[model samples]
Target: MLRRTVLLTFAGAALGGSLWQGAAHASEGRSPYGPLQPPDDVGLALPEGFTGRLVARSGHRVAGLAWHAAPDGGACFPDGDGWIYVSNSEIPLLGGASAIRFAHDGTVRDAYRILSGTNLNCAGGATPWRTWLSCEEAYRGRVFECDPYGSRPARPRLAMGRFKHEAAACDPDREVVYMTEDEKDGCFYRFRPTDWGDLTEGTLEVLCHGMVWKEVPSPAALVKATRHQVDDARHFNGGEGCHYADGVCYFTTKGDNRVWAYDAKASTLEPIYDADSPLSGVDNITGTASGELFVAEDGGNMEINVITPQRVAAPFLRLHGHSRSEITGPAFSPDGTRLYFSSQRGRRGILTDGHTFEVTGPFTI
Candidate 1:
């Protein structure tokens, strides 16, 4: 029998037993669960003003998505006016790498099977140079920079190292890139390009503190060591979703239910938000035009949480059946007027169907 779960309330009580206790407690102050309505089974819900329509469906194991602006704006460019690039982590059990592009109107414009026979087509980030870095989250992981516009072929940036990479973010202003490892005791990494606009060679370092896990040096030494050394010498937890702002970067950890901010100047890791807040189950996160932060929840009660500058997380949008849906990709339009995101079905289970959607809002805090 298919079970139905009421997100804001029951899911909060249940998640309170696990890693989301903080979020549960925080939600108590607000009406975390909204009114139940039609289409609840599908896991989608919206406020009175906003509406959501299915843009593309069943697009070959779609995961991460990046939205490019249309030269001449008419609509949000759902089909193919600009370009909608999707990552195929696993296609029909083939276990390879592939990407597809659609016209502003959702027509299949072009496709590329960049790397064949690979596993785990997880989330990736866009560069200031206008390229996509698709990360491979497997043993001996690697990061590939591919030209979605077809200017360059997809190839692994060897200087970025090989490990269980989750997501990659580039700071165009500094010619430096940041990467995260998806391991139980993974480390955060930074790549400094030898030349501007060229990522051929650079130094890699893990984050480390005086005697704590400040940051590791690049070309990390993941040697086996004691628990103290591992904690102090190494960074840990499930590293996922990275975004760059002014001079700091933010990343998520599914295992810890925590999000961290890395200050470029001070070179430190400070906690930005935690799952203990009202926005628990945060999976992937991105920034908005007004500088607010939005996060997607992977667990049941599928909803997007918005974090205000005051550091409070409120329910942004409730995807009716989102618990069964894995919300992965969240990117804003070039004008920042529209937000595009992708949802994957059966990632934690069986069944591999993916779809994309465009959301517009009055964006009130």
Candidate 2:
């Protein structure tokens, strides 16, 4: 991973991007945090000395509203002293995002909707300025910047382009927002905003072979899909989650079961893990401040695996009795001790049985 000093030269070119403090990302073959222990009362398996708790469930009363179903990609944002975890609703029609506010002591002080009336909100990135970019996963989906504090109205960012959008990550060093497409033949893209920290307007560029970038002929794609507009755009197999840290942008693709790394400063893209690896069905991704990355599973095993700094990857946590479910969000608290994620479909969940969770322990840095 590139350090701060090494990335300073290009920082001026990219202008404004996110420096997400609670970033998550890859692994050494053996987890630095050790192996998983036996299951707990809630059927959650974690390393010894770690404990899991139920934060919220779909259709259940949280704060004053029912928790949304099919909780998808999530990112954590720091509040005054506490922080907020924002999760997207992958369901279609009116699907949006919700926030669970935690006091400094880990208390759930509030839970409510942040983005609404959107379709299939799948995954989004957290900006350095403390905002959540909620993305719609539908055809021609748009990115909406939602204030987790619920003090402002959410706004749609159409300039990001229209396509089967999946996850997004902001590379402040490059001064652009990196996004993934969910289609089997989708392309990776970057939104170069007119100004840093502002998503209102930007030019969407498609990534081609050899880490080359070219502007989408028609960014809005009013008549055609943006992914198809670029003849030579690199096609990823069902792009999932994406994250940026230490000048490296990491994204996952479920189709070929691989995790890819793009070095912003180096302008290079390559596969770090493949189908034969322990992590299968790779989806949403985030990294630790210590440089470890956690890749969640959309299916298969119901586990969230960690990737150590040595590039070694291993199971960090497993939720039993949720075989029928898929792990969605995987983010750390502001302090990095607690991890927040969710089983998109619970033990008995077909759709509405989703559950948001929190796991706390002596997390290795």
The top-ranked prediction according to lDDT is 2
**Which 10-residue span in candidate 2 carries the lowest summed lDDT?**
4-13
RMSD of each: 8.8, 6.2
lDDT of 1 by residue, 272-323 (tens): 5654555566667787645566777775466677654433466767665445
lDDT of 2: 0.84
**TM-score of each candidate?**
0.74, 0.91
Show the lowest summed lDDT stretch of 10 residues, model 1: 68-77
The Cα local distance difference test for each model comes to: 0.56, 0.84
Q: Model 2, residue 204: displacement in angstroms?
A: 0.3
Clashes (backbone N, CA, C under 3 Å), per candidate, total: 35, 19
Which candidate number maximizes TM-score?
Answer: 2
* lDDT (10s digit) by residue, model 2, range 121-163: 9998999888999888998898999999999999999989888
